[model samples]
Target: MSCHVLYGIAGSIAAYKAPEIVRQLKKSGYSVTCILTKSAEKFVSRFTLENVSEEKCYTDKEFWREQNIHIHLTRKSDILLMAPVTANTVSKCAHGIADNLLLNCFLSFKGPVIMAPAMHAEMFENVAIQDNISLLKDRGVYIAGPIEGELLSQDLGVGRMIEPETLVECLSVARFPALSLKNKKILISSGGTTESLDPVRVITNKSTGQLGKALSNMAHLYSADVTMISAGDVSSIGFKYQIEKTASGMHDALHHSIKSHDVLVMTAAISDFIPEYSEKKIRRKDNALSVSFKASSDILKSLSEQKKERVFIGCCLADEDTLIETAIQKCKEKNCDYIIANTASNFGNSKRDFTVVSKEKELDSYSGVSVQEMAYRILSLV
Candidate 1:
């Protein structure tokens, strides 16, 4: 409520909606000031924005003012909120083309910045634009939706402005200075690791990697640099991804990533065994095929020596009766700072119950119908 927000508006049809966002943030007790680019003035009047923000709106004309408005605004604001960020603006920001007042401040501001992009579908989908978005994301920017809905052209795809209400909610998520994971790098391994029997066939579990994906998103929300290494669906919020095919491959991938991260979230359902792989298609020989197996190398066990200072979080799935004890043992075996275990039945289900243990002692248990609960639990430990 006591926060100062610098709201930047770019040239786009969605610029008309900027006033609503400023009004809402102001209502929430944020001291909102608006910065409108030259092109943005065509869509939204400066007088209107100033009326809603209850503060004077600045434009490119102020860029050369002797008062040094850009630097002052950059240092004064607690957060920078850019709404209706056009593709042109996005590309310029990404390439360090600070030709406008808003971008000038954006370059100098040392606070959190949230970008809500809006443009034509094709422009938004352009490879260059996506790459720029990726660049901003790597810099720890929180990007809200350019949700799919009715575009001003009456065509619908992915380039619509996120409603002001949703923008407000997302901005609140970025307001936590106390819980900020500003300088930490978090590595998460997720998804069901697949082992190959042949080029045409694979061995995999029912895990869909939703928990890992959720945790990655939550970690981003806390401003941590997130890297997801997985064999399944993963988000590239940060600048790293390691997709492995077999258990041994997954093991190698995790081990390669261990030393660079401050915290390791190992939720990957890595296969325990791998069948002897065939170079070619293993045609059914007389309808009787024999397969041999060997245990995959343990990823966590190999890292015990190096995990003394860094935080390691491990997850185990076990039979109901052995869940708690197994989780405790896993923490000791893996040198984990914390361990979570749940019944094997909860592996592929949407609802899950997890028993949390830390430092060889039982912590509390968490049960939820949504992955948000687990994400919160993991963040609390971090």
Candidate 2:
């Protein structure tokens, strides 16, 4: 059976987006039960939520009508999510106010709680609200976002709730226990490295870095100190990262950053071959052009040579016939604690098939799993 999510909607102008969040949760194969605050009903109806979630929607009326409703809901839920959670709701949840059913549910729910705050810029930035958010965060609540965007007043700022799709994605990843990496530091590399053949020409791969981004987000959710080395834009990821466009650049960055980290996840697709550099763009003439290539340095092998107390996770891409064998061989040859093996088809896909192999033997294999879930499974091994 799929996991059950107890979704709470609070009073905010963004409440209209709540039904879509329910729809997204259901679409992601999560059974959803929604609860709405009295204030939230002003913007969205319980009927709409019930229609979208395909489950009964609870409200304050149910709080009085039903016995131990909050307890029952909390007990049945695998996760609790509050999207477009207003400043009032945040304060109430932080202070243990339970006048409403949603508040009661929040107070009673013992599982993972994810909140996406939405309100006016001023309200979200107020010292009181900030303090409440910090308190909840300290208590292991996962705060998704109050990202910068257009608010109810048509003003642009940081009080806007993230989109329903992103909120669902956050919920998917945040289902894991909080503080799983409390005292650990992780270094990760992402994207496909570029090897320049000329001023304007380069060799690159099809890696979109989505998995790397997901892994980084998962690491942050688990409370790990994360540093990313990327060959692509990671501005959306709120972490410390350095840009490295070439294989050599990524190699150097990893070496510099690996010393302080307890774990290294090598997800970058470094070019296998580097062409001889050309200072200027090669002219297209009648003569057939030929380029000579040299193999790029093996970053993982070199780094593993100096591995002392650190854990190394390597990723390998191989043909189906040799996938498991290649992963096993790479795990031993590169001295990796674990190696994740996949195929070229998974390069830019959100759902991927993966096999995890240790130096000793194959550990586990998953088919058609989200990158977020894959990240969680991989980290669980560490």
The candidate that wins on TM-score is: 2
Write model 2 residue lDDT over 64-160, tens digit each, in one string.
9999999999999999999889888999999998999999999999889988888888998899999998798778887876767777656997788
Worst 10 residues of 2 by lDDT: 233-242
Cα deviation at 227, candidate 1, in Å, is 1.4
User: Against the true structure, what is each candidate's TM-score?
Assistant: 0.61, 0.79
Error of 2 at 149 (Å): 6.3
Candidate 1 residues 1-382, lDDT tens each?
Answer: 3889999999998998898898888777789989999999999999999889889999988887747899988888999999989999889888889898998988999988889899888988999999998888777778775767789757987888877865765665554443557678998888898888888877888778877876776676666787888887543433356787567787777777877888998888888888888888989779798989898888888877778578888998888888888889888888898997877667667777888897658988877645656766777788
lDDT of each: 0.81, 0.86
What's the true lDDT of residue 17 in model 2? 89
lDDT score, candidate 2, position 311: 92
Q: Which stretches of candidate 1 lie over 4 Å from their true place?
A: 1-114, 117-178, 285-288
